[model samples]
Target: MAARRASHAGSWYSDEAKHLGKQLDNWLSAADLCHGPARAIIAPHAGYQYCGACSGFAYRQISPVVVRRVFILGPSHHVRLSGCALSTFTKYRTPLYDLRIDAQVYRELEATGHFEWMNMSVDEDEHSIEMHLPFIARVMENFKDSFTIVPVLVGSLTPDKEGLYGRIFSRYLADPQNLFIISSDFCHWGHRFRYTYYDRSWGEIYQSIRNLDKMGMDIIETLNPSGFTDYLKKYGNTICGRHPIGVLLQTVHSLQKSGNNGHKVSLKFLKYAQSSQCCSLSDSSVSYAAAALTFE
Candidate 1:
């Protein structure tokens, strides 16, 4: 009966239920939903105040999916994980609701002996996966019943291991009842994040940084899985969730090869913004892009 409590609620987002509801409502209200039913989404996992509105662009696309479960794949910032870490907790607590863990799916995934199961407490310090819960809760709140979640903390993996994990997920993705939410921010620039290769004071240099983000986003929006990975390697994009997004791309590619009829997918770039654009701070900034992948 134990639950994984929200650790960043008050600071990262609103702690009070009503205030949190209003915050989410405002974001969703202003968001322009993309043209198709979202089978998957790529959203940023930074604090709600920092990237919440950007996240709404992706969430708005999947707002209409009548899903029973969501597979949240995010990078492990605090933990150096191998393969993927599945939470052992039974529920995930947020301001909106305590989401039930998809025990069956977790058990099934674990039974494959392909992934490691964490002691559940590991989630307490991991914000990448937890930060998306409230947005997901608010987006799916209108559904008849609460949906379950399978929180997967992705880590470093060898090519073979990555491909195997992708194959495992491809089957699940073939199902329409499930959704995948990839938590990631595009670029972390400035000396604060230790990625200071450019002088932000120079307008041209800053514009180039924005261009780099666009290049990455274009690769993702084109559904070129291999191209995305290659682009990251060529440019060393500091997208924190690259591994998670890599896995997602690998899984989708696997599904395509297997002739999964529903695997024909295309991504729509919904929005992009620099942290400086959203806040007063201009010295350092993290770029965020919201995109949705829809299946044919």
Candidate 2:
């Protein structure tokens, strides 16, 4: 069965591939105001019930051109790796299907100074990356050619280092047939999030996250590396894959500067809703949101 594991089935998303695909399909079908086919995106990887709609927005904008590969740079939710972790798993089990990892690509990056193999904690039962499977599957169901994937879980990337990496990886990333995905979610507000008593709709939670997201989005729009880090630090943002976003921004800017930034590179606000907004009338609160990025 090509070494595989059902890390988040039945919990983070669903155990039935069809059902999961339907859920994502429903969200994408109704999305509007999205832009071109993007090579990369910053998506939230939380339980489907919460952020699925928001994440769907990003998936909805993807137009699989000649993409032969997908690189999901996820966050470290359950396990931690030295620099970044590259999974040796030949197949990553999801409800829709067990997608194969491009082993040779993994090795190629490993050969490069930018990549490294992870130890025991490289990948555990984490939904940060897995939650996105059905999404990609739904989008690429019609892809004519086989697709490859490289899952990179990044913890922290310094501002200066991110810039250097951007410069170094520009040419490496200029290839038009690859897609980059940054797995992340916005601010984790309140007690439910260990930030405070997120269980209750306290004073003003939306205000806080929106205030923070504004800063984060600005950095993305401006393609500013330092601005990204400064904003993240100032608010002590809880974006799980902050470092991954740093790498992505650097990588995106590198491509733009090199004159190969693609046809339609853009950031779109797909979905945004706090957990409190969705909690049952009788229940308390939670933080949740979804957004998508696309390139044409």
Candidate 3:
């Protein structure tokens, strides 16, 4: 099978190996390492200049975990589909290296009857999962054999479909070898994003956006899928990856119900930031955040 090429390389991040390597190394170096392993992580899927550093904070925590298989759940910005689409490509190409796709796991998942094996072209330009590869490749070099990924793109769907997919994927979480990476960016404030409500004043819009993100983060920290959905129902926080995150929480909650203790599953807030702090203009800003799900 033909591999999906890096479509967002130069624009979103470095296209050259040396430059990309150095850039990623810098981000990883700057982050403070977490004490333990992370079963899952929620990171930003924006341009490097905007959210790369914030993503680094979460990836740093993932670096310690020596898992052979990673399950990546990212929001689909371009496509709209029910359930989740798993990439059928043999590998995902990147400047750093072409990371292999976990074909065995992909086949197993396909056998389960939940995910549709998407055409390679469907994932060509999607940055959500592609953006995280270089970081994983850079930080996870300790693996003797290059780790493979199972990339799943989640889209808008009915609540029943959401819960169905959630329960489907939760079955795999029983294995400690399977790591889940949820790609998401927090809030898109200001007029450019058409999410404006508050004024453009730095202090006001900044604080308001941060407060909104914190509310969402509080729900995530609780690891309560229903609470997060309620927050979304009450006030639609513009979290781009809300669906994927919801699936993750639902998966965790499902495990909790089936004799898997909930106390062992918890979240750790890593970092949060505004796009204005990076380089975006003040009139419009997108918030970014990083967190890890630890199952002790």
Q: Report, for every candidate in turn, its global Cα lDDT versus the true structure.
A: 0.82, 0.68, 0.82
Cα lDDT tens digits, model 2, 1-296, are: 44557677787777887788788888888876356466666678877888787777777667676677888878777655445667767877667766778887777767767766554344656667777777877787777238867777675666766665566556645676777777877776555555432223333545545656666776766667678788776767677777877887787787788887655566655556666542333333444444445555
- Measured against the true structure, the TM-scores of the candidates, in listed sequence, are 0.93, 0.85, 0.92
Stretch of 10 with least lDDT, candidate 3: 196-205
| TM-score of structure candidate 2 | 0.85
Worst 10 residues of 2 by lDDT: 196-205
Alpha-carbon runs more than 4 Å astray in model 2: 119-122, 167-169, 192-203, 257-265, 277-296
When 1 and 2 are scored with lDDT, the better candidate is 1
* Model 1: worst 10 consecutive residues (lDDT sum): 275-284
Q: Which runs of model 3 end up more than 4 angstroms from their true locations?
A: 63-65, 144-146, 199-203, 261-263, 277-282
Residue 216 shift from truth in candidate 1, angstroms: 0.8
Q: What lDDT would candidate 1 get against the real structure?
A: 0.82
Clashing pairs in 3: none
> What does the lDDT come to for candidate 2?
0.68
